[model samples]
Target: MRWSKPLSALALATMLAGCESIFGSGDEEPITRLPRALTQSEQELIVASNRFGFNLLREVSARDTSSNIFLSPLSASMALGMTMNGASGETFSAMRSTLGFGTMEPAAINAAYRSLIDLLLGLDRNVDMRLANSIWVDQQFPLHPAFVESSLQHFDARVTALDFGNPASVKTINAWVDQGTNGKIKTILEQIDPEIVMYLINAVYFKGSWTQEFDPARTSPAPFHRADGSQHPVQMMFMRDAEVRSVMNDQVQMVDLAYGRGAFSMTLVLPPNAQPLRQWAAGVTDEKWQGWIAQLHDGKLDVSLPRFRLEYDEVLNNTLKAMGMATAFDDVAADFSGMSPRGADLFIAEVKQKTFIEVNEKGTEAAAATSVGTGVTSAPPTFRADRPFLAAIRERHSGTILFVGLIGDPRSP
Candidate 1:
């Protein structure tokens, strides 16, 4: 969410036939569209999710107003949605309310997510977008079978049981995250805590080339003013004369830049002259956002945008708590019995996200990964056989005993 300096010129660009010099002239490709219309549930879910995303952004921005903030609300929602399947009682209610799910049942919510994922992945042939999910459980933890089944059926999440004590397990999980985000994000966890029993992860990746690319020759060094009144030189990309859709008012100017068959686009919002972007963004609501989007009309406008890249990482525990989800973080009050028979001991320990984004002459490339970790309130008792002990091998499902032995002295093998 790096803010570029306000454009020096906001007037319409001159109509010139020199398209070959300013924009690329390529054969038009067939537009790819959604396979089917969105179901009512899917549409509702998307609207609610957008509101949640906006709220989450405001909350995160309130922490440090000047810093660049970028996060994938989709990644966070999907990861939390998966975890929500394992919640029960007040924890479930709080999470559902915080996510803006309202009265939607769990089954309907999961179905909507599944349909939405399919629609997004198939929307545009030229755009590359992928979503992936996974669940990691400690070997000794007894997770509920129903939770595993639902995650696989609804979210297509990969489930694995790992030896959390082994340091190699950290590498294994990080490798999956690396692959999921196409290497934009390499690791989500530095180490697994001893009290942690499970982790739910989601990753999203997107790369799209602009419908009309900005010519590199037009890019020049320009002074970019910072919110702190500091000025720095930046590589500013210029579109001299392009038919761009835009909307403007006294407070801000908004422009839409389409990407690949117009299935997706990037909207650039610039605040009024001498006004800090954070000030304007803090007041942006869902209704205001929708109004701005609806007012966009086609026009020939000259655009000056700076190329930038950003990477951000943050722990969302406090953020979610402030958003009315405190019960989920409480070890004693949290109820996730749907996850395990011993759910009373389980609580959400952490919610973390890492994100990367780069916008250049071609288009935008972004990737993000979010992880939710659950930990036990107290350590489970450990059994140590310092004296004689009995050992047996048995089949769990059928309750068939295979072998038994009594060990007195290890030296007398």
Candidate 2:
């Protein structure tokens, strides 16, 4: 068997809003042209967000020492970034800094994301990857025209108005998520609360075959180490290829497993010993992450990896609050004035994410969804996981990590 970890994010909030005529002409709007080149600031922002994603990974891992974790910070960031477009003043400042966009202009951020998405979606014809965003507004609420246009032009979000108080709306939104994630996520919105006025949803899906597929015949039962110094039997997949790229230092060893014509790959980081993965991940940073990639060279090493699968769900309100996005979750302090006409009456009520992943000898498949809700009220919301291992799926060109996981036990179903 092969091991793969799929990830998803969901963010939901509520507010009052009405749609205006500012979404451009007809049912079909001119496709917003994306720049072929990414500015230095745009590039920096991508690097910064990757750093934040890993930091957030450590925070989530710290919660359950024995459980597994899988997440897509990209999904979370993109969904929240759409919501952040409407945030102003302190709320904007707080979200900007927390999401790692910093003091960068919102226009640049959106443009960069547009370009980045286009780049990733078009990177490999052999890899199936899709990134989608949508805004569901209550028919009774009045949304700003600019918010609608920006979402359309920059994020390619499908803006729709629905009766949020009706049960049918829940089904419609959930259906969209399901389809966007290739049905890996069946339902992101179970029941729409009466207080919920809007939902900014983002979904990501990826499927790719290994460039050099591993032979199933080489698989064997191997002894896997645990954090508690115990040993368990696991089906370890072995690969010994001379073309593999790897880097090692006193702290850790890194290996690159390519996929789909080499546009993307799984980067596995191993600690020097069977130390608790949480401890090892705490030291991970953008510099260290980049250094590992930079130092990678063609090297031959026997790679033995366990075959496993993971399904993870996480509530990120407290996590985001801890990460300095507290005000966005605060009902009184939160300012999403730029999003809806009733901005003063709105605040983020919840931010949730669900993810799934599977990896095997052939390749990998993963999915993630993130939903952000602004409402009249309030709410909030790994890997290895072998002996506790860290893994990330990244695009080779931009080094963007789409998924991060930690496995605690390969035996867990």
Candidate 3:
């Protein structure tokens, strides 16, 4: 009963920036108007998406406690959101619940994503951010018109039909990824599997200069203690008596480093010296995260951060299955009839993601690409990052988390 033709979905995120002016000097105003108000459903969707991100992080970190982990939850959700259009019955319910969609109807989920994407793209003018989706189909596969129409209308995805049998199609698809991420990520596929009848992809790119740029002249080599009791020399950038939003308690020290008129920011969470980064992260629930964010306040402190870069790649089939979406990957019990008449035979074979990030005296540049084969399947602050810590890039107004990661060792790329 296993279907030979599988569906693949991919998502990517990239961030790029450089040195810029200081934020919150006490007199500056936001350059752009505030983003529009969100509907109740939109607001609910945002909460659900963030919860899903936290859950995913917990699952990924638990699997490997001493490695750098980076991912784009928004990108993965959007890609799967597009694919969800074709799911029905138990398969559909499993995905909706796994994504924290709760009782929201499928149409509501699609509408929320459409509105959210528009709002994110228009929020900060000084920052360059883009979200794009695409659906690539085998030339001969029969896709339901309604499924195609819904993806186009709700996800704003580009639809392309090509000969999956042609090797050149890989280049064509990767070209779109390169363009979407502004060349930060050039490829998402080495070769499309013949059994994969369609590929759904989402790409995100963000570039924003720090409101307060670090002075490269002040950078010095410092020791970064690893979680394993080892230490290595790292290029630690220092900013003394800088005005930024920060909070601290017995468990962790967190700070918000703003970008582009304070709309987008990178939040860094540093666990106490006695606590392992993984142990601290394991206790973070959605409520705990929200509480910590609410406690951030403007303050003056000395800050030291390491200039580090990391690249992470992982197959997420097991992670998603662990999150309660196992039915979608089950060959016999899965259902995707909403996508096409061949729904009974379609199952996700695999899901994969590759990510890259670099932070230095100037700014941050990050890129991530996630591939779901139907087969398928931060901050800152005074606080020095001289040890393992956590980071998240987010939009302040809507509380939308674009990226999140854990840095166990800065010396390892």
Candidate 4:
């Protein structure tokens, strides 16, 4: 029922500039403008995403403690949610359990996702947050109408019929992905294979300015301590007595940075030890997460964060398989009976993600895209990330994390 409005020039610049822009677009994308309120079901869905998100965070950390990691759990969730529509039997059960959806009825699940999307689409008037979903089907493949309707109604996913045999299909799908991610990700598909009958994609773009902007002139060079105990000079952005919410314990300190009207904030957590934040990330459960948020109180502290940019790409097939989703990737054993008439033949070929984040004086600009390839597939206090730390962009009201990262080396983008 929603209609498109003209995109502003500022939005255009942010999309085209990717995350290199230090500040958000002068104008934000118009809010959803819808007057409807979120239902209880939708609210529960948000909570589910949070649970699934944190679990995934731990797995990501456990998999690679040595390298810097960044990802968009929201993007991956939505993409898989769409694909989940056509999943049946073991595939459905496995996906549901892995995503923390548990035994929730599919009807309720879709409704929750729909409401979550609508609510987020309208939450921040001053922040540009966009979520896009689409399905591309091979001309020769036959998709189920029920699946199509569910995706369109619940996800507002655009359905396109394409000839996968033609190379142009790759460009077309990539174009949609690029546009959805504000060009932060230029391509998601290199070449569509004949066996690849369809693709389910989700792209998210977010740009938010600090409620209290940092003075660029105050930025100075500071030494950033690496995990290896080496110090490297970095452009350290400084903030003094700025408004912030923080919490701490013997293990780590958490700091929250507000954006615009405060519906969203970046939570940074600094662990005391030189070990990667991943080592401790697995311990962040819903109850513990709630405890940290409840303990946060207003505080004043001098902050020093390195001005850095990170662009990361990761293939999640093995990680997901290890997380108990092995059957989905096994072509011979997989069952996607709900996706297409030939569901038995369709298996998730791969799962991959691309993310971009830039933190500077004004604010932060970040975008991420998750491609299922049929495929289907933190916090801080005291506040200095001079060493290794963890960061997450989350919605304050729902506690939904849109983006998360572990910063090990900032010297390279």
Candidate 5:
């Protein structure tokens, strides 16, 4: 998510005159190259984020044939949602009325979602980025009795291991996933618990474009050797380029690239001669990623990639605590009295997230990206991520960490 695009000082107040042409073609015609319109929801942002992560994993996931798959501890960890059911004790009529989109106005739902967006996108100037998450399941979640009852009790949400062949449920959940993922992913929580009350979810998915877009013509069925020296024919996107960047400390040769639609990008770092990926990933930090990216000087390069897919599950209750959202997710410390009369008692029960993604040449192969921020260096309308690198979905205003993660591999881990 690059924000270096320049905006002309030709203030819109004067530029909007009938005589002035806001469009870049100079014919007053609208510019077709403009980016897509900013959309809604933090989880929607996650769908975008997953797409990007899926893309990068293609190149980096194969680092160790024995155990080179990448699953974000952070990705599998941080999640937030509030669901209420069977309110019998406290007076939650006002809040309960908002059950299942029937009680709450779209404006209210959008407002709550926007509150998260403001915080998640608060940072953009820094380049450290991997995956981000924020999701709200008000309309899609089933109409639980808790929404209309009093003194709501608990909440929970789960992404299915496999899709349940249902019509309405599939349609609703898939719709959100489709829009959030820009058609890259079609089903997110296909196995949603119909009995649950409410779901407020958010996530960030990202991956850069391929330095070398896999030419369908060259992709061949080859045996991707495993560390155990075992081999099986796997459909791999293969290319050979000579100009990739090299690092000395890790003896890793790497480069960067972007996925289709220019939505997200990634940089790949491989051991000089196939070093163990496990050892390399163990020491990863936000700062080291920045340093590597800072050293990338554009040069001719050759690259190879593979086709991949993956699904990740996380128990985010703990990671959120590590990140400072403990009080909110904690039942004992929570102060959601504004949301329920039970006060500390009416706190988050469990936040579980299951996110899936696939990477290929066809535009994120199911991707999602979301950000908001106003930085000293307004993000460039364009940034090409064709190597091993770090990226973030900054709000552009607040520069917050809405969602972040790594995609060492998109294959099921």
Candidate 6:
């Protein structure tokens, strides 16, 4: 429960990138954060978006690495709606450097990642335009521009529907979440201010299958050994599968596996000889990160990760400083002098993130929802999250993850 090891600002920034797709897929249509102003060409944004999506998938496969994430793919689902205000621009760039090996030429990687950037940028600016079309075109679930607003918040990009630090407006946000999650997660924003415009959010969510599936019949209220070895009754989701990754590290057996479509996966560390380490040893570094990745081999073992749902609604008010993004949030030093012709003062209002996850043997079912709103008069773009979803906040041009989160668990603390 405690990632005690402090991640250096640079290291934490690098680590956050590893969480783009805590649970994700490439085939799903995107649920965009609307209220985008697209006066500039998105050529760069569009191209980069596609590559970013694919690279996200590749990252999922090499789950053996330090980062286990999936950037949402819905951004690339549609193209016509990527432009707005009757103007057209495209974005194309990638964050391959965020992954590994800076061996390739910068130009080549940029070209490859631009496809993804396009999609991410498209969602930010052109999503409302696309959503207007999708409600009629999409059959299963669709949404309208429930609310709208624009700001030169994060640098120069005009942002809309941001609820970050406000504590009074949870109802509206709750409605959207209720809609997007199909009511799976309710009142997640109870503690948030509907007026708070979230500028940056980073969320992580995951669910893992037990190597040995729990027998429905064997399911019993067993006392789970706490970090203190104390007992607590927990519903053990058990499953026995021959297909599993096994690694013995520090005498502990680690079982790691992925969910369907490899959207997001989980890795479990079990203590051996009933001896647990002092904390999770989250202090595992780049070298250990590599070893954990290499240890995935075919093996058979009985495993039981306490069946539980753990979630974190990370409010990045302090995280901004944690990730070196403090300037953007500060009213004084912040220079968002590009978004508006008026040279608008761009300061982050808030960065609210909510994540929910349930772990079971079959697979994981989760959703991430985030709305970074800016201070504006026009009723902050209404974003009704009413069904299952995955959301992101990125540069309309570069497509970096400003924030990402999942919401599917019904239980909220």
Off by over 4 Å in 6: 1-175, 187-213, 261-264, 270-282, 342-344, 375-413
Better of 3 and 6 by lDDT: 3
For model 5 the TM-score comes to 0.49
lDDT of each: 0.65, 0.74, 0.80, 0.72, 0.34, 0.32
Off by over 4 Å in 4: 1-38, 273-275, 375-382
How much does candidate 1 score in TM-score?
A: 0.83
lDDT of 3 by residue, 58-166 (tens): 9888785547988898888888878777899999999999888998999889899999988888877667778888888888877889998998898898989889899
Q: Rank the candidates by lDDT, best first.
A: 3, 2, 4, 1, 5, 6
Per-candidate TM-score against the hidden true structure: 0.83, 0.87, 0.93, 0.88, 0.49, 0.49
Instruction: Give one digit per residue, the lDDT tens place, for model 4 in 175-221.
Output: 88778877777777777765676777788888877766677788888
Kindly report which residue stretches of model 3 are placed more than 4 angstroms away from their true locations once superposed: 2-4, 16-28, 31-33, 375-382
The whole-model C-alpha lDDT of candidate 6 against the native structure comes to 0.32
Which run of 10 residues does model 2 get worst, by summed lDDT?
12-21
Best by TM-score: 3
Q: On residues 91-123, what C-alpha lDDT tens digit does candidate 1 reach at each position?
A: 999999988799899999999888777777766
Q: Which candidate, 4 or 6, would have the higher lDDT against the true structure?
A: 4
Error of 1 at 36 (Å): 2.0
- Candidate 5 per-residue lDDT, tens place, 1-413, comes to 31111100000000000011111221232212323333444434333233323332332333323232333322322222232221222222322231212243333444444444343333221111223332232332222333322212111123222222344654764565455444444454444443332333323443333323556677555554444455545455544443333333444454544322222244455533444444455455434545655665544544444455554444334533343344444334444343223332434444444444455543232233221000003321222122222223222222122223343332311
TM-score-wise, the better of 4 and 5 is 4
lDDT of 1 at 92: 96
Best by lDDT: 3
